[model samples]
Structure formats: C-alpha cells, structure tokens
Target: MEENDVLVTVEGLSKKFCKDLKTSLWYGIKDLISNIQGNKNERLLRPKEFWAVKDISFELRRGECLGLIGHNGAGKSTLLKILNGLLMPDAGKVTIKGRVGALIELGAGFNPILSGRENIYNNGAVLGFTKQEINSKLEDIIDFAEIREFIDMPVQNYSSGMKVRLGFAVAAQMEPDVLIIDEVLAVGDLGFIMKCFKTIDNLLDNTAIIYVSHNMPTVSRLCDKIILMEKGQSLFQGNQVGKAIDMYYGSFVENESNIVFTNGSIELLTIDLLSSLKMNDNIHEIKWKDDLLLYFKFKLNLYIDIPIFRVLLYDKEQRPLAIFEPNYDENLLKNNNGFLEFTIKHEGIQLSKGIYSINVTAFKRNSNEPILRINNVLSFQIIHDEDHFQPFLLSSTFSTK
Candidate 1:
C-alpha cells in the first residue's frame, strides 16, 4: 500500500483517566496550568490515574477493515472514542485524510428531543454533507432503516433496536472515506444486522472501516486484520484473524468445571481426556478425524436401577455442537463398592479446527431428573492445516462441468 492509500494513521496513542471524580477535576486543572507553563509530562501517571488506552498504533487503508475485540473495560471503546475524535489522547497523534462517519454509541450524536429526520440531517451535516447531498440520500436512509413510519417521531421515543437501525443506516449511507462502528449493531434485529453487513461489504472497496464487536462470527466475516486488547494494551495485532479470535476465546476458559445441577445421589470423581497431544494440563489436542475418548469415574451415593450418561460438545463460544449417548443395553454401568468407571468413545470426530469443551449429564433410566449435570469438564483443540468457521468439516467431493 502506498502512503496516500492509508486513510487513517495512529501512532503511539495513549489516554488516561482518574478513578476519583474530584481528584480527576483537580488533576485536570493542574495539568492545564502545567501545559500553560510548558512543563507538562503526559507520560507520567498521577495519583489515582490509570491508562484507559495506552500506546496503541495501527494504520488503515482503503478497502480494508480492522477489528477491535476484547472484554468489557478492556479499552476497546476508549480506543474508538479517540479515533472518532470524541476524546483527546494524552500522547501521540492521529491523521485522517477525508470525511469520517462514526456510530460509536447509541444515540451518541442525536438530540433526544429531535425527530429522527432532523437528527439524520444533523449527523449528515456534521459529516460535511450539504442540503442537496442529504436530500438525495434521505429516502435511501429511511428505506434502509425500515423506519419510514417512525422517522418523524422524537428520537427519545425510539426503542433501542430502532435507534440502532436508524443510527447505522445514517452512518453507513453517508459513504464517507472512513467509518467507525462500535457494538451498537448488536441491538438491532437479525435481518437489519444482515442488511448492515451487506452494506458494509458494498462499501469495503471505497471505505476504511474500524469495527469493534464481541461477536466473533461477525468479526471473522468482516475484518481483514484483527487487534485483541486487554487492560488498555494490545495483546495481539496482525492479519491472523483466526489466531486472534482463538486467543480471545482462550482468555475466558475456566480452570475448573461448573456444576450446573447436582443431586446428592452421585459425585463425579475424575474426568480426563484420552489424547496423546496435550496442549496443557487441561486442554488436549486432537486431529480432525481422530477418535475422541473420555474416561470418567463417579461415586454413587444412592444406587439407582439403571443410570444413563450423556456427553455434549460445545464450541469456543459455549454453543452446543454435538452430543454422544451410549446405548443402555450395550454399555451397562457396573458399580464396585459404590464406585463406577466407564469410558465414552466417539468414533471419527469431524469437528473443525478450533477449541471445544465437554459437558456431562447423568440421569435415571426413563426419567427426566438429572443426577448430575456439569459443564466444561474437559476442553480440547482440534488441529488442522486450515481453519473453518463451521462446527463440522465433512468430507465431500467437488466436480465442475
């Protein structure tokens, strides 16, 4: 990419905030005075102050999308604010070449008392659009937002979904050189969100986008590059979008199982993943089509006639993917001195390349009541040469005429 092709450039950007309101105001006054005296040191942190965003740098060119992803309070929002010029950085600089459209927060640039139509024009004007330009796009915005009936109502009366629809429609329809979108699209309906994504796809060749989202699937679908943030710092930044997403999910893994519901009748003793490649003490690595073997040991407090066992698999986002249940007649649970041991074997697993977790449930024969239900008993990563967003990677043959 050439130098002029880079529409947005951020270098060594940093911002800090004081935890205490009174102290923040006092420090603000002191900093203003020090700046007047030409003796201010923005790099040093004062008492009760911490960096909300620190030393973050990236360049965005036309026809590319950059994704910012992290947990709440990880400074993703703070970085967007800085990029949209809503907050001033204590250090570093940002350079942009053309008009910028942003929808960082719900109802951010709109007046509550104003109607939706008025706010649309107001936002367009802020983006340097004249009356004729706004007029040409007015019907398109209303149609895209699907709020033709509610366009004349005050913005305060709009629901969260309505506000998001209108906000995104205006920001995306403006066709600005650079677009900054936060997580506001999460509030819109699925159909509307799909429409917004299509619009983004259409705009990608002419616009540079900075997108912040918690939905990994959408981020994976749209972003060409990814930045993972943690505690006001960049944990990972590069074109490896899949790896960055994996790292984001890895940060949330729990060390121990979460018992959802358990009766006094059974106690889980030990659960282990029978894999040759162990990523850590807890996570195992398996090939794409290899068999998945799990061993379990349980202590029965109160004996039942027949016990049923169920094993479920979940993706990185905790969505249930597959389930395994053994035939009651084939595999009988034998108890020796109130202790039972069994193994569940899944032949020819077809999971794609990603992290997965195991969930277990036990119940009495022909009963809906559960003796034990636990989540995240064991976690594993499937290894493959290529990454896929789908849960399963089935073998198929392709032909063309």
Candidate 2:
C-alpha cells in the first residue's frame, strides 16, 4: 500500500454543531457576516457549541474497505457528510484522488420532481458522463434497481424502498474510485441487499469503500479496517475489525440503564442464569460446552392471553447477537394473577470466549406492544479452551424446556 495508491486521506478533521437549530442558524449568519467583513478569525462557537467530530484522521487505499460503526448521534453521519462534500469541516482537510459515489441518504442527490429515468441521466451527467455513456449503462441501472416498470415515474412518487434500490444501483454502477454507503441501504429487502453486496464485492478490486453500519457481521465480512466512532470522532481504528465491533457494542450497552417496563399487564421481575453442566447451580460464567438454563420470573397484574417470551442475546457490546425462545404452556396465562417462573434450557453452546449479555421481553402475540422489555438484564462470561488466535464461532442449540 504505497502513498500513491491512497484514495482518501484526512488530517486534523473537525466539525462542530449547536444543539439548538436557532443557535446554529444564528452562528452561520454571524460567520457569513464575519467573512464578508474580512475577519477570518470568527468565533469558533458561541453558546451551546460542541464538536460533532474532532481531530479525526484516517486513510483509505485502493481496494480497501473501511467500516464505521457507532451509535446514533455519534457523529458517523456527520463525518460521512464531510467526506462526501455535503458538509464542510470546521477545521482540517480531506484529500480524495478520484470520483466519489455515495449512497448516503434516501434521494440525497436526486430531484424529487424528476423521473427516475431523468435522475439517472442527471447523476451520470454530474459525474461527467456524456449522454451516450449514460445511455449505454442506463438499462443495467434500471435492471439492477428492478424499477423498470416505474422508471418513468417521478422520484417523489416512489416508495422509500424503491428509492433505496435506485440510489444503490446507480452508485454501484458508477464504479467510482471511492464509494460511500450508509445505513440507508438496509431499507431494501434481503434479496436486494444481497445483490448490492455482490456488486460491492465486485468493485473491491479497484474502488475504495467507506461503509457505515451497525451490523457487526457485515463489517466482519466486508471491512479491511474498522473505525468505532463516538461523539463524531474516531474512537478506535485498526485492522482488528472484530474487536473494534465488540467495543462499539460495548459502548452502547454500557450507557443503557436497567429499567423495567411497567405499562403492560405482566411485568418481569428478575432473570437468573443457571447451568447443569457443572456442579455450580447458580453461575454467571459458563464453559464452552456447558448446558445453560435461563430462569425467568415475572408477575401479572392483569390477564394476558398467549404471551410470548422473547429472548435476545447480545455480545459484550450489546449489539444483538442471537435470539432464542422456547415453547411455553398456554394455560399459564389463564388466570394471570400470580407470579410465574419459567426455565429455558440450552445445550451445546458454541460461542467465542468473551463476555455476552441477555435481553429478554414478554409481549402478547396478537399485538406488537411489549408487556415487559429488559435490556442487558444479565451478563455472563464464556471460557473456552481453544487457541486465542483461531477464529471465533459460537453455535448453540436449545433443549426442550
């Protein structure tokens, strides 16, 4: 990876923002006045100003994919905007070597009143493609978007999913030197997303990619390097993508407070972890081969028929790792006036040697409303005997409850 192969570079990048919209607008006006009055040293920020991203630096080389993972409002989007030239950095510089294609937001660079067909040509033109060049790839774009029937319809009339399909298709087909994709691509169906990934994989030979997402598995699959963002800055960036993703999830889980939901009839009281694989009855740590049992206790204030218990497994970072549920007796909800205890048992645990957490909830099957939801109710550490350098894979199955 020589410096000449570099497609993107950032130096001392910083962006600041105001929580108040009025304050931001006023600041903008003040800066404009100061610029007009020949004052380059305008106030960096007035009251309530904070850096969205501060002193971030990174580089992307040809044929490399950099993943950005962070929680909402963590400045991932803000940094992407700066890279895509949608927003300017308050300080520092970004250098790009080639044409940039981005799927940053829904209908981001499209005109609402223009038809999809027209927008295709418009985007191509913006990329300096002649009418003939656009016309040649036009069918492939429409075919990939799967919107040929509605290609002539105005973009404003398209559904959100349809717009996503078109946006990703155009950006992928352009095959620019640098491609930026945000989470909006997830708005498409699974099949479409798979197709998009295939296209991205094909582009990996030459195009540099900056992928922003909360999906760790996808990051593991696509990124050559990973960046964990916090408060608009790069908290961590390294080739250890898996560990970086774990940290990203950890940041989210650590900030969450344990509070029981009480609006519904049934409320969860406590959750316990038990195992039969070892002599210890109640334990917070488990071996890789252990049989684990989840003990759930909840109380009912009103009758709720056919309540469904949903259990979500998360890695140390609180990112959703898996979900397991067992069948329960329907008769238990008949009275719904007394406390209930249930056990969910599992065997053949296949997971990496690290800390994992659980989030369990109960709700009526008929409605999506939750009777009770708990986030990171309890955490357990998994001890394994495998070599630490080996790849981590967790495979487990639930036994009959």
Candidate 3:
C-alpha cells in the first residue's frame, strides 16, 4: 500500500472475557488484598477466558468505507471500542495513521447532568479538540443538529431522538482521519438521517470509515468494502460488498435453527413467506401488489390468556411505514399451534422499485403484551413493469395523486 493509502492496521487482535461470577468476585477481593499486600500477582487467579475477538487482522486504507456486520454480541462493538481506545485488546495491536473520532453510542460521553453545551465542550475535549477549536465549530454543530433552543438544557432532559441528533452532529463535525461508527445510522428522523449520510459522503474523500450498521442497503451504497463477522471470527474480508452481504444473509439463515429459546413459555417454531420469493441479482423481486404473509408456529408451555402480536414494516431508509396485528378475539386461550399467521399489505407505499424490510412481533392474546418481537423479520422487493414506464420513486408527482 502507498504511504498515504494505509490508514489503519490491526494485527493479531484478541479480546478475552471472563464468564465466572464467583471467580470475578474472588478476583475483586484478591485485588483488594493485593493492594494492601503490595503484591502485583497476588490477585491473579487465572480463570478461563472467553475470547470476544480472537486473532483478527485487517488493513484499512484511507478514503475507504469498510462495513462491519454481525449479529448481536458478535464482537463488532467490542472491536470498535478497542479501535477507538475505549478498551485495550488483551493481545495483538492496532495502529492508526491519524487522529480518531468515534460514534460508538448515542450520547456516550455526555454527562446527563450537564447542559448540552457543556457536554459538547467536554466531549470535544475528550476527542482532542482545543477550547478554541470547539468554539469555532460550536455554531455549526448547533445549527446542524437544529437543537439551538435546547442547547442550554441538560442532555438527560432531551429525548432519545434529540440526544442522537446532537451526538451525531458533534461526532460528524470532528473531521477525524479515522472515523469509527457503531449503529449511529439507526437513530434520528428521516431528514436527519439523510443529512448524516450526506455528511458521511462528503467525508469519504479524506476519511477511512469503519461503519457498523444493520442497514445492508446503506452499507452497499456507502461502503467500498465489507467484512462479515460471526461468533467473534472474521468469516469474509474483501472489497466484494455483494458477496460479503450474501454471506452475512446466509449466516443469518443458518443461525435461524439456533433461535429456539427455552426462556419463555412460548417458542417460535417456524417462519416463512406465503408467496414464491426470488432474489434476482442481489435484489429480491416480488409482485407489486401481492400481500405479504408470514406463517408462524409457536408452542405454549404454560397457560396464558390473550396473546397479542404486532408486525411492522420499514422502508430501505429504516423508517417505520406500517404496523400490523392479527384480528382476533377473547377466545385465544391456552396453548395451540399450526394455524397462527399474520399478513401485511402496503397501500400507501409508492416505492421507486426497491427492497423493503418487514418486522414482526408476537405477544400474549390480551393480558400480557409483547411476548416476542422481531425486527427486520422478513424482506421483499417491488418490481415495476417496464411498459408502465413512470418515475418509480416516491416523489411529489407519484404521491400527490
């Protein structure tokens, strides 16, 4: 790689976690005793280690957007924390060519008790920005977040969405050489999200983005490369974004068999589509007006009165478009299976011929709500006929009618 091209290099990076509660408690006491005894190794009782990230190596070049994808608890966030200097790897090393800016959590370093303006200064200082530098960017940050009126209020008083907007605005304006983002795209309103994407797009010329998101379409559009990670191991690493996405989806499907949960009395047995589904050239194609059906089978180990289920749909931009619940009565008592299903039909959606996600939920019939909820539960694409020949996007002309 050219001298300027190579931005970040990670080598043999490994992070181990401890699983034993008693051992952890013992170690804590031992450390206290060791501090009194002045013995460094006195507290060291070696317990078995759980490797969250094990011996993963990769090179990220400047101006390249790298998409990191994995299931929950799959070590994606751990890797980002290590890269952002929040956590140190137990083994191996990470080297960066320039200053780092990270958006790991919404309002991560913000003090809840402090005003938004105070937190901005505090966070900016932590990010290596001088007081003078923060002063210069203060107006821009406030303007971008569009929260000028609430700038003097404590961040704890801000709504979840407002906090996300302000936090993202600050991080994006930092203009670091290496930017590490973890699911920040999952926040904010649609207009703010579009603004975030544009800011990221503008930074693509000088920054190396390590983007961790659940939106695959956004990943495909923004990232120059993709990395598929599973169970703390890098499964695939290359510039082939499409193949990596396919691998991610395949892993998701393979792991479906492992979703059998014994925690609650209800168990999700099977989930499948009603219509014939075809994924064409990395794009799922379904008839424009077909109703989306989901078949679900669950076994109830305990007697419960009134179970409720909710199904939701999200556009490619991750906006909630619709929510569905099956029409049922007070007769849904006891545990039965084989004939429970839900359906969704979007009459308001005037798609520009693209893919969309379907989210689902399952709860008790009446008494206790939200038994099981699933997001991005299903996916389908809409295809417009060639002869219809209308601008296929959601615009004034199409939606106004």
Query: TM-score of the candidate numbered 2?
Result: 0.74
Against the true structure, candidate 1 reaches a TM-score of: 0.90
Candidate 3 ranges with C-alpha deviation above 4 Å: 1-4, 25-47, 254-401
CA lDDT of every candidate: 0.85, 0.77, 0.71
Ranking by lDDT: 1, 2, 3
Clashes within 3 Å, all models in order: 0, 5, 10
Q: Against the true structure, what is each candidate's TM-score?
A: 0.90, 0.74, 0.62
Model 3: worst 10 consecutive residues (lDDT sum): 254-263
lDDT per residue for candidate 3 within 1-401, as digits (tens), equals 46358889999888766678887687669657866886533112266657788778988888899999978888899999899887767678899988788877656679999999999888777667899998999999899889999999999999888898888877877878898888876768899999988998898878899999877778888888777888778888888786676566644441122332233756665565555367654444566555455566666656655356666666555577666646466554334452333333444345544456666556655555566665665566666542111214443544555
The order of the candidates by TM-score, greatest first, is: 1, 2, 3
Residue 13 in candidate 1, Cα distance off native in Å = 1.7
Which tens-of-lDDT digit does each residue in 1-401 have in candidate 1? Answer: 45339999999999998999999999889878877898646567888999999899999999899999999999999999888888878898999878788867544578889999999888767666798988999999899889999999999999989988887777776667898888877778889978978888898888899999999988998998989999999999999998899899989988688999988888899987775366664678899889888889988898665568888999989899988964476347678789988888888788989889989888787765788899999889888987677789997789996
* Model 2 bad stretches (over 4 Å): 1-4, 33-45, 106-114, 254-270, 274-283, 293-348, 353-377, 383-401
Cα displacement (angstroms), candidate 2, residue 41, comes to 5.4
Best model per lDDT: 1
